[model samples]
Target: MDITGAAAVVTGGASGIGAATVRMLAARGAKVVVADLNEAAGVALAREVGGSFVKVDVTSTEDLVAAVDEAESLGPVRVLVNSAGIGWAQRTVGRDGRYASAADLDAFKRVVAINLVGTYDAIRLAATAMSRTEPLDTGERGAIVNLSSVAAFDGQIGQAAYSASKGGVVGMTLPVARDLAAIGVRVNTVAPGLVDTPIYGEGEASEAFKANLAQGVLFPKRLGGPSEIASMIVEAVTNSYLNAETIRVDGGIRMQPK
Candidate 1:
């Protein structure tokens, strides 16, 4: 799909992969909307990319609608990147080996709510807006890219909640694409390995920790970069032939059981 003059909404656009995507899309001549809860970073990045910033909590439909409206105000909404997500770690049964110490139900639900439900909320709102636009020569109105994780498949210990949430994204890709096919909208997903993002802190200790984590990678012997993942996301959006697929940007790491 041609994105020139089109508008794109990127959740979690404040930093990491989302920020990289906003920059790339802007360079491609698409008007971008930085939709994120990080007001400061979102505003800064939007200004740098010559886009608009909308504070959005993905779990909130009202916030998502405002973001879609903001994108529409810029141009036709043709792209949406569901990059906003959160993670939590705890085995279904905790360290104490007792039901009372099992992973907090509230925590698990919160992770699924934010990572899975929030993603769908953004997709539905944006797809609705995209449906209203005129179709292009290829009969395509828009494309969507949702962020999953290697955990969705190669889930390790303590990843139950994160895996379930991301797995839902993978599970829904083809069906969601089929559902939106009638409207000429395509859905795809990108499941990344360990990408270097702010979630990892900086410092000698952090670097050493990350370096150790990199040992598991099949090749490139390092964590993935946000820009690397963003490149694939941009391709997913611009490549009209790619649809209903979940591409793993990881360097062939299958993740070990912890």
Candidate 2:
């Protein structure tokens, strides 16, 4: 689908891969909305791209609705990127040698709620808005790109919650795409491997740690960049033929069990 002059909403757009996506979309002439929780960063990024910023908590329907509305105000709502998510590391059972202790149920629930449920919430709302728009010459009203992780497939130890949440995204792509076909809305997913994002702290220690992580990559011997993932997302959105597919941007790395 052509992105020029289309309104695009990208959650978690203040930083990381989402930020890169926001920049790329704006560069392509899409009127982008940087939806994120970080007001300071979101505002800065929005200003940088000459787009709007809406503070959003993905779990809240009201917040998402406002974001979609904001996007529509810009022009035809044609793109939605669900990139807000969190990670947790814990075994099903306690790892501190405590017998019968289980992982923090609340943490597990939070991760799934934000990563899985929140994503669906955005998709539903955005697609609804897109359905109201006239289809392009290509007969496509819009496209959605969801952010998953390689962990969804090769989950490591202590990644049960994160994996389950992302795996849910991969699982729903086909069904969601099918459901939205009547409206000419397509859905796809991007499962990225390790990328240099703020989740890792800054400074020498962080660089050293990231280097060790990069050693596992199959080629180039480096961690993926946020722009790399964003490029794939743009492709997924613009390539009308790409639907119900999950593309991995990892450099041929299968994670090991931690």
Candidate 3:
């Protein structure tokens, strides 16, 4: 897919990987819409990249539609990066009164809603919009990139909800790609491992916890940077043959079970 001069929409484009992707798409000459819940950051980033910002809550179908409409107003939404999501860590069941059954279930639903369902919404609507677009010389009308997590595969003890939501993302990639194939649209996912995103804010995760997390990385013993993950997203959009694949950008780090 040729992104230059294309209309692109990135959800969660206010921070972390989403923010990085917004910049990447803008730098590649794509007209970008930064959609996120954080108005200040979203608007600021849009200003930075000379793109537009749409305040959105991924769980809202209306918000998603509005975002798509905005992107189409710029032009057909040819590139969509579904990065708006939430994370939660709690075991499905626990001993010593550790488990909160109802709370856990609620958390699970919320995670899946935002990560899996939200991503699907973006892909479906964006593809529909892009369907109106004539295919380029490369036979591609659009590309969709969704974010997963290494936890989808390397799920830790307390990451049931997070992992399941992300796993749903990984599970749907191929089918979604096949569905969009005939329309000259592509869908893929990026499952990042231990990356230095805002999942742990400053002075949030303990120093020891951080060290332990990085210790598991097989090499380059550190967390991944947003730019590193963003680069792969750029590739997923630009590299024509790459579809329905969940590429792991972990540093050979197969996580340890807790």
Best by lDDT: 2
In candidate 3 the C-alpha lDDT for residue 189 amounts to 95
Q: lDDT of each structure? A: 0.95, 0.96, 0.89
Instruction: Give a tens-digit lDDT track for model 3, residues 1-258.
Output: 678888999999999999999999999999899999999999999999988999999889899889889898887678999988888877666565655543467778899899999999888888999999989998899999999999999899888888989999999999999999999998999999888875666674555667778988998898889999999999999999998899999989998887
User: What would the per-residue lDDT of candidate 2 be over residues 28-97, giving only the tens digit for each residue?
Assistant: 9999999999999999999999899999999999999999999999999999999999999988987567
Number of backbone-clashing residue pairs for each candidate, in the order shown: 0, 0, 0
After superposition on all C-alphas, the RMSD of every candidate to the true structure, in Å, is 0.8, 1.2, 1.9
Clashes of 2: 0
Best-performing candidate as measured by TM-score: 1
The estimated TM-scores of all candidates read: 0.98, 0.98, 0.94
Over 4 Å off in model 3, which ranges? 96-103, 203-208
Q: What residue runs in model 2 are displaced by over 4 Å at the alpha carbon?
A: 95-100
RMSD to native, candidate 1: 0.8
The deviation in Å at residue 5 for candidate 3 is: 0.9
Question: Lowest-lDDT window of 10 residues in candidate 1?
Answer: 90-99
